[model samples]
Target: MHQILLIRHGEAAKSPTDADPGLTPLGQRQAETLADDLDRQFPGGEGVRLVSSPKTRARQTAIPVAGRWQARVDEQHNVIEIPSPEGMPLAERGQWIRTLLKSRWDTLSPAQGNWREDITDYLLQLASTRDEGRFHTTLVFCHFMVINSVVAAIRNDLQVVQFYPDYASQTHLAIDDGKLHLVQLGQETNIGSLIQ
Candidate 1:
């Protein structure tokens, strides 16, 4: 069985106009704490693969973990954030995302559906190809929607939003016999009116 850990990036320095934002001070601290916790759980990072979305926040979150494990992070565009509609202003993205949360996967536009499929396909490919006689764990540092997409696909749920994952939370999954199974959902936080 191959293990997959989907980690959400820490709190970002969200800005209305900024298309890409990095982590805040607290978020950086959170990333360090996460690195320590993960290092203790998987000593020396043996048989571990580090992956991160190309997005700034996700890359930032993976840095400390990479340092702790002495591993390089492979940046993947397939694991990046869900795409907003064309011509949508950056400031209006949050509202669009809020609306998307209320919808179902089958109801998504073609582009969105394609994005979801790509994420699942990429993960399945990773899970299928593993070292012989060794159990490998892949650490995917990604965005909220990316994690939600995987969880929803495994559970066979049609909802666009499965559950709210807290910053730096890790959701566990296992791939056995060409099937993906959810071991556990990540920590959740109730941030009323704050969607980031």
Candidate 2:
């Protein structure tokens, strides 16, 4: 079995108009704190493969840890944040997400539904890659919805919002027999107004 670490990116430094936001100062601090904690929790991070979403915030979050281990971050766009709807203004994206949270994933439009499928499939493929029939661990720094998509797939949950993972939260999972199992969910913070 391969153990996967799904790390949500730290808070972003962007307003409602930003289509792509980098990490905020506070967010950078959070990532630093996460680096220290990762040393304590996982120790050395020696053999773990590093993967990151192709987003500014996620790449920023992955950097310190990758640097500490002298590892490279494998950026793949499939792990990116949820795609906004056609012509949806960046300013309205949060509200759109909030609304989506209350809805069901299976009811989305073809394009959106395909996006969700693609993300989940991407993660599953990552989990199944092993060396010499041995399981390996992968650390993925990604967006909130990308994390949720995998969680939902594992739990058979159709609802969009399975849980709210805090900034820098790390969720653990194991893949065995072509199935994904949630070993542990990440820490959840009450950031009701910080949904973006």
Candidate 3:
């Protein structure tokens, strides 16, 4: 079984002006909490592999957990940030994201550039290594769209779902014989689902 864990970046600066924003103070706390939780949930001897998106926020979130797990993060392009909208006023960034999300551009054909080829290439690499039995667990630090893209790819559907995981929230899944399975979502508070 290819056990995969999906972790969203922590709370980021709420600025539409900056091309890429870092995590907020609260976000840092969230990452720390996540790290502690991981330490409790899975000890260092579990043979887990940790990876993160190349974005600053995502990478930051992965650091603490990776350190605890004694795992160096392998960046996956498939787990990068979502595609941003075209030129828009900075003040409208939040609202514009809501608008775009409502439309749900779920699956993009490889021919149309809707999907980044680099991400796909990396994903193929991941698939190829699924059965090697090198590790029992894997963590992926990624953004909302990238997470949703993984879901879309796993389900083989195009209907997009808007997912807003709290800062440093996690969603767990597993892959076996080239199939993805949802384990738990961090959004469920009683069960630590929406771990914001």
Name the top TM-score candidate. Answer: 1
Global lDDT of each model?
0.88, 0.83, 0.66
> What does candidate 2's lDDT look like per residue over 1-196, in tens digits?
7888999999887678777789999899999999888877667786688889888899999888888878788998888888889998888988888888788889778878888888767767875544524437888999778878888888898988788899999999987887788999999878562364
Query: On residues 120-196, what C-alpha lDDT tens digit does candidate 3 reach at each position?
Result: 44544554554476777777787766666666556665655435555666787776666566777656223122211
Q: What is the C-alpha lDDT profile of model 1 across 1-196, one tens digit per residue?
A: 8889999998898888888899999989999999999999899888888989998999999999898778989999999999998888899998898898888999888998999999988887776544644448889999889998899999899998899899999999988888889999999977552355
User: On a 0 to 1 TM-score scale, where does candidate 2 land against the true structure?
Assistant: 0.92
* Reference-based lDDT, residue 51, model 2: 86
Between 1 and 2, whose lDDT is larger? 1
* lDDT of prediction 1: 0.88
Candidate 2 regions with alpha-carbon error over 4 angstroms: 129-135
